[model samples]
Target: MINITFKVTVGLLATFGCYILFQNKLIANNVFAGQTEEINQNNNEVSEQTNGESEIDVVNFNRPISPNPVHVPGWYFVPGFITQPMKEYNVHLKNDFQITAKVGLNNTASSGFGGNYFSWFVSSDGVNWDKVSQNKHSRDTIDTSVLTDSSDTEGVRYYQAYSEVQPQVFNKPIYSEIATVHFIKGDVNATEIKVNTSKDYLVSNPNFDQYISASAITQPKGATGRVIWSSSDTNLATVDPYTGKITANPNRKTGTVKINAEIINPRYMRNSNVFGYKELQVKKMLEIDGETNFQNTVLFRLNPDFDLSKSKIEWFQKLDNQVHKFTNISDQIISKEIKLQDNNSEIYAVITPLDIDDKPLPNNATESNHVKIQVKDMPPGANRNVHIRQSLSNISIYGNSENIGVHQLLKHKITFNDDSETYGYNDDNVDGNLRIPISINETNIKIESIPSGYVPDYRIENDGLHQDIIFENFPIKRHFGFDLIVSTRVDKIIDSSFDYNPVYKYRTLFNTDETVIGKPVHAEFSTNTIEINPKDINFGEHSKLEKDDVNREQDLDNEKFVDIRDKRIKYSPISLFVSSSGFQRKGAPVRNVPITLANYDENGIEISPKGNYFEVASSMNNSPLKSVFWNRKQGLKLKFNKLNFPDGDYHTTLYWTLEDSINSQTK
Candidate 1:
């Protein structure tokens, strides 16, 4: 058969071989052959075993399983079981029984069936097992494309997958661990201080030597350095440069003091520092009462002990509404008084320190108080009289009685004198006094006499005289009346005298009975007649005619006058003898009758020659009539009839004439 058969068979075998070849070709074409087949088959056997183990009663087995069923060891059942090497089996078996495991082909018995593998199982009881994966395994390299599904089974221990299972090994499990980190902190330091001053000082220049300390903690990277100060900062104090101490000027203004401190780093951080303050002190000055009165020693003063060396002082006064420098008074004492003029009305004073230009010193200046003084009447007695006088003898007139007719004329005179003794008089007599009087005295007086046949029958009328006198006369055909007047003390009289006579010649005849007749007849016959020897007469100082002279002149001449003329005779017849008739009556005386013889011769008788004849004739008397009379006298008198004569001059005349009968003519 081999040959025939080989032929046939061979042919057939060839055909079969061909067929086998074709079939091999077909099988090779249709399925993996050889190692692929063996791989497949090993894979199928692993699947079967795994399936069989999955079907095994895990309750009946005695091994324990993990509580988390979905979690499983990743490196498990990586090789076929029956074909696994003993070491691999032992390794897998030991890991399955223990809690921790390492798996590889050299340690497990089934490792040669492929590489190495381990079992992953599910169990409800510790002794029973249900295969989750079997004998096909991979290493620990993660597969990004593989996913786990626990949905179909409950109480699943592990989620797992198989590696390409020609031989098997498994991967190991991983665990987590713990870690730690670190940081740091910061700090700060700060401080403050205070100081005091004395009352005597005006300003404090605290030197840097006197210091007040300050301290505090600060932030680590915070500000740290020397502090600076100003009047503006917030939380720090100012320090003196010389003393290195902190103090305020007493005159320092009240307000906030700002301070600042900063660390000198490339980066700067500023810390604000400040403090607030006020000054403590008592201030003073002055006012004056009466500045004008403070002359000489007056003064004002501050406290006596005040030190002028450390301070300056000056003074001034206000005058004329302006301030004037007191050049006179300047000293350390705060008080002074100005020496004022006596007439000054107002003044004021003020004081200040020399060092300070604007500040006034305390209790330094004042004003003073004023006074006023008043001004006292002038004498009444001292004056002398004037006197005047007049006289009255400077005016008068006189005349004879006959040629001036029976009227005669007289005269008057006047004069004046003064008797007052005083220059002026206060009395009625014009005597001595301051007051004088008015005087009236006689200045003149005058007189006029009336004619012989006319009388001035005068009487005193408004008489200013103590007495009055008057003169009167009749018409005697020849004489006028005479009067006399005088003024003296009450009854004194003054006398004057004058004589009077007729200017015509005339004669008068009177009978024995003193009858005036025409004329005397015979020259030898007796008659009465008067004779005036002078035609006129002046009776010098003798005022009266003697009675003997008047009678002697009248008896010298006396005469009688008669008329004898014609006679006739006739014859008578009766013849009687008449011769003897008267014889008896005159017998003795008539004895001689001589005429008888003449008669006898009657017719023719011539015989009478020796005898004379008888005859008759006329006669006259021739002599001047003489008379004497007073005319006027001197004195004061009044004429009531002539009172209206206006106190001036007047005159009148009176006359008488005689006629002769025998001659039929006037004489």
Candidate 2:
């Protein structure tokens, strides 16, 4: 949620009088007015009884609960009377109400307040306080007629008072009640029908995208009445009839507009101020946008609409406590050494508009929108993501799927912004088609699926030494599925850091004309080795051959051909070779009628027979994935007369050798 807080006005008592107040033992005053002599004599005893605050940590100590007002005779405003919880007032321009704190003297010899010090303080938000009024010789009244509030729109304010007597009489300082005041615009209860309206306003959004909010605070707080609004010049600005919001005319470059709001209540008497008009100055709104780089180093920029020579920019940073402003730490907008307490802090800019002559504009300045950022503080180009990973539910068809490690899948959610806006990794994204141009870089990866918009078609084609996936027409939406294929540098097991050899490569493109190198997409992989089944081959029996059979061929079923499961996730150049010994008839001596022996590769292609061995189907560099090597005809073959050799379930053992990693030589 993005929230904006405007300026607030404060009262003199709250801002100039609120300060440190020490809580000590309360001193009861002498009820008898004639005990002035005895009271003076007991001053030492009173001072000794109330000096316990010396041991207390005043700033951090728990504030004593606001005691219910004691109506006892001499406690006067010991709770220092500012205002009560039920008090309400109006400060139209400035009300003449005098806020005073009366301290009832303790039972001392003197009946009158002679020697004492008094201080008053005020606060808008309860947590922060400011001193507003102070005096010696026991003066305690605050004339609010000259005081203005922190905000012209907000009416609530808080006040507290501290008082102490001199000459060691009743050594304890007096504490005041936290006074709450709800102010209506003017003395509406005493006037005729008058609506709450400010005296001046600045309409900064020249495009009229922003509105001037009219505050509806009435005389009686939540008074049941409707307000009607009007503008003096339609070309300069217009007011919403029902909402009372004022919008500047976008067509008009510069001008002054007057806004009038009328309250229809007829109970109060009429006055000239009842129809007071609010003046608005039309100007361009200054805006600031912020973005983070690689989750570190926040970058901020002002919109180009701003005229730098005539306007000055000031930057402010607010944590939970609004303490630091960027301009205070450094004059330059960019400060690498600025401190950020956490990711929750927000930074914003206040632009003071100046005229052609370099003088400030009257009644108005624009405040830019604020942003929150997370700074990892890494230099640049560092990918701190633990792994390329995602979690998807259910299963579907495999366009190009494998049992890859779970962490290898990159489930991406990208948001496109206008070319003018800057964005960093993992920043908040809204719906747009062409923001930052991003390309889908797939390293043996695939586009599994997506939630919305377009996902680049991860098209694979061979390019030089490594394979690359080209992201064609890839303008991404919110969420898209990018998957991976098993392509390793070599047939070796890898874990932890998977920056080893990669058989395929991928990257992003910017509008076809520009390109920026993206962060490394790394993953962790488990070691998988080539495996083969140790099963025997069986050829069905064939009938005896006649003289004419010597010219005919024979068919043999090598039941259960060579089976291999290439568990290796990465590609390694390897091939399976084969050889066979002569066929041996059980009870008869070994004989040969020219037997043809064979072993198949994963694709069932017979290994090419060299003097004794054959080369089976090779690898996936040319094809895709073929893991086994063996054919159904991988058994002894004969084309001779029955007289040449007797066929009594003759069999031969075919020898197989595997060079699982032929390209690299070993294994």
Candidate 3:
């Protein structure tokens, strides 16, 4: 007689000491932190606690309900619990999943009848049945060929087996647990991972984009590729998990960061870890920024990526819409003095980017955005396409006044513009004072007049050394200056044998080369005969809005300029008179702007000589003669009242004369 024993499933709860034990099935022997629950499978109330998002169902059968209970007889049966292993993942049915029924054959059991062999049964629904395989070998464990079809692709499937023997009335089959297991198209796990970067290296700057991409090889027909990216040091750089794009911290000067990418589908292989990594060089991009400060300088700054000692910089200036090459300033130096022509123009910088090791980057050079340096309210004479041509004349005269600034011979005027109020006037603490150094190389000369708001300070004197009449608290604010009559007198009987001419030189805030700041240029004044050269003052194109003041470059083509040639004498000589008739349009009776000519050298005397004359300059001498000259820049500057005239070419005549000393005549 043949004998048969039973195979037990693992960890099955025994309701009446007859249920089976199953692995991966809910088990909470000792009360844990989670909420406790009772297992009741008959009512379909079963709970499985796990870390994964999904759980598989294990079928438990009632021993009393089944006519063919889960048992094999060796003429008798022993009650026990059976437990079987279960998987948490969606068990792939397309792959090999063997449903083997294990039964032990007793060598000699005299107790008689036993189950013959094992037969396998399958089910689409849990309640239905279909016998798909039979165990032909009488030997012990039998394998069932459980081939999955497309219909079994979703949900759990049921597989079970029962052993048969000669006269097998007591040998009944108990279904194997839930689909021995459900079907998946194929293995969906990622086998390997590959990552790629857009560029070989990275330039670390917040403004530029850093990019990387990844792909995973999932061999399953229906499986989609997945990618998970990470950065070794998130403080320095970070990579997106799905997109693999990177963003670096701007404050990080220079550093290396490792990028990692991996992908694995939990459905097929939870323990399979496939990944790839690439070491990227984070280099710094060179950058620059520029601004124009109140000190009239363009300051350039560089990013901290380069060694300033080795990385030099060059500056360029754009004037009149044309780019021009500028001086290449030394590295580590930032400030550049702005020129007069730099008003309303663009300035930019180009630097060759370098690494900390003093090596140039792959892209050597970079340029900063064009910094438009707009120097506002630039002096009328301090810009291109328009000018206020004026200069200080060399003073040559014979005088015997006691004080210096109070005399006519050494008199100088520093006139403020008509629009001086446009700029704010601050106190001495804010806007500093103006210092004028009067270096007289001769002797027996005294300062005659020190204008009220300004006085000489810090007078330094040494044997045969220079002198400075410093104006300590001149009280003039920024862009606020007035016609300062700087007058001084000379002794009547001191060194008349040599030439005598003292020039009051004060370098204005703007450059003296481009604009005549101190004196009218290119004129030789002779102390002999009298003459005058008045150039045709062609105030260039003017819009109606430009009613401020003198803002035009004169016509240089006119071979005419005004000259006052006065022969030096000790007082009481003659008086020079000036007058002008209002200009009228050529061949038309319509009048133009009324003339409000200001003669600054003569105490800032402004006259609107409609039809009369005004005495402008005089000395104590009864006889006066020759080679003293004046141009628009030297002694004559015109400032008109509010302009309310029509546009037209206008002409006017200016009259000047020197009164005769003996016959009371005028020249």
Candidate 4:
């Protein structure tokens, strides 16, 4: 009986084992279908969550379906539905443009059990679904991928997930509600960003306001991201963070400064170090100050607040729109005596800033306004108020007072043919001074007249063309008028042979060869003649007298032959006269005029007995003639001597010569 029982039990156990094996194979073959159905249902639920718009879920229908396997008797049973299903899910995006979906579950620990898994789905549209990836167990989160469709246009990607689960009572897959996300379809390429408004800007005020701008030529026009502004030298300038406006720093020195702008977009320029940069140069203005109109000396200076040590300055003169550069200049204030031309004009200053190394800074040169130079008065000789006086006077004949001294006077009037006239009494009130503010070398006056007597005597004070005259002292008065006197005194005897034809010439002392020949002052006097009436030398009656010393050693006899003698006699003095009309006045002094006489017996040969030949009317030395005295007269004394001789008519001619040697040693 035991044997029979064992056979039957063993056969039954074998049959049961085979049966379990076949069922396991069947579950394994059918599990996939159930999981697929659960996934479809999950997708439908996800579609419901997405506003009831169902998406065409494409799956790998060719993939093998699987079934759940039964456990053996006495095997431990662990519940696959330990955690609840996920209800809602959301898709999140990061800065790197990474998208991920998180499913909301009642139980946070929602790992799938049995032959189940979790899958993520993505689609360009709700109609066509594309598989992203599948996980072995359903989880709370899953990563996703967004790609470009056949067209290059980027579309909003619709996303969904499926959680294949095995509940204690059912075996299927469930899907969470769809979480849609819009992603960029193509690769991120940084737009070429450039800093606009990059140029040198002029700063008028100490605080200057400038702006910087940026541009991108890529996919999005306005979404280039945050813009940042920076300055290469903060001491020179500063820029605003939010606004790209640039401003000069406080107490900023004038120079060239650089500014930069950048973009902070990761999607676009991810690998680029520099986004957009530009060199914005800052410029400051220069100015000049001080007086514009000037007479002799002027002071001009530059306005401060600029680095003059590292700068260059130039001065220019502008006349009739023409520019002329001044070779001599000072960087700062300039005080100099200026000479203005006859025309009207102006001057200007140009300043240029330089770099540290003394190079000209770019776009930093400036020019100043024109300063005018003008004169205030008119020039000399603008009118005709000057003239020369012409008159003759002083004539008298001297005779023995016992003879009633006869006198004759003749007044000669002279007329100047040229405009070289003298200042008349009518010109006393007119102004003849030079009014122009310039230097004058010389001026002239001409006097003319006719006379018949002694030449006028005159002397000039300060040498020739006196340099003591300058613009500082003007309106020089020239006195050419004078008084004349001519008289013959009986007390003096005139030499009949005296000659007065001496010429006084004017010459510049600087060069003896150079003479003021043709100028206003030239030769001055004419010839003069002296006449004397014949007079007899009388010694009462002739007397005879004896000289007792013939041969005193032989016989001192009073009876010796006697000799007769008469004393010599002196004649009355005669005088010569001179008038003002014959005088010549050089604006300067004249040298000593000499008088010489040559005695002859009507022959040109000089005779002997120099003392008896002739006597001079006057002697001269190195002294100059006085100008104040208009007339001069001098007398010559003649004496007679008698010797024992026979004579009928003894006549001798005296030649007289006068010379005017102007000073040649003037300094």
Candidate of highest lDDT: 3
List per-prediction Cα lDDT, in the order shown: 0.20, 0.38, 0.40, 0.31
Ranking by lDDT: 3, 2, 4, 1
Instruction: Give the range where candidate 3 is weakest over 10 consecutive residues by summed lDDT.
Output: 5-14
TM-score of 2: 0.22
TM-scores of the candidates are 0.14, 0.22, 0.21, 0.18
Candidate 2 lDDT over 1-667, as tens digits, reads 1111111000000001111111111111210000000001111122111111122112211123232221111111222222211112223323333333444333232235455556656666554777774332133322111222223353556655555543345345644444344444433231223333322444333321433333333333322223456788887777765445455565524468777765443335444223335667654333223444333444455433223444456777666666576545322244333232334555666555454345655334445545565544533442211112322221221221332333343332222222322224332222211111112222334343333334444555544334444554443222333333222222222332232221211121110122323333443333344455535544455556533221113223333444655544455566666566767777776666445554444444444556776655366542322544323343323333335555575667766566554332111
Better of 1 and 4 by lDDT: 4
Displacement of the residue 383 alpha carbon in candidate 1, Å: 56
Candidate scoring better on TM-score of 1 and 4: 4
Q: Which candidate is the best by TM-score?
A: 2
Alpha carbon deviation, residue 537, candidate 3 (Å): 41
Per-residue lDDT over 507-580 for candidate 4, one digit per residue giving the tens place of the 0 to 100 score: 11111121111112111111121122222211122222222111112222222111111110212222112111
For candidate 4, the 10 contiguous residues with the lowest summed lDDT are: 7-16
- Kindly indicate the candidate among 2 and 3 with the higher lDDT: 3
Candidate 2 global CA lDDT score: 0.38
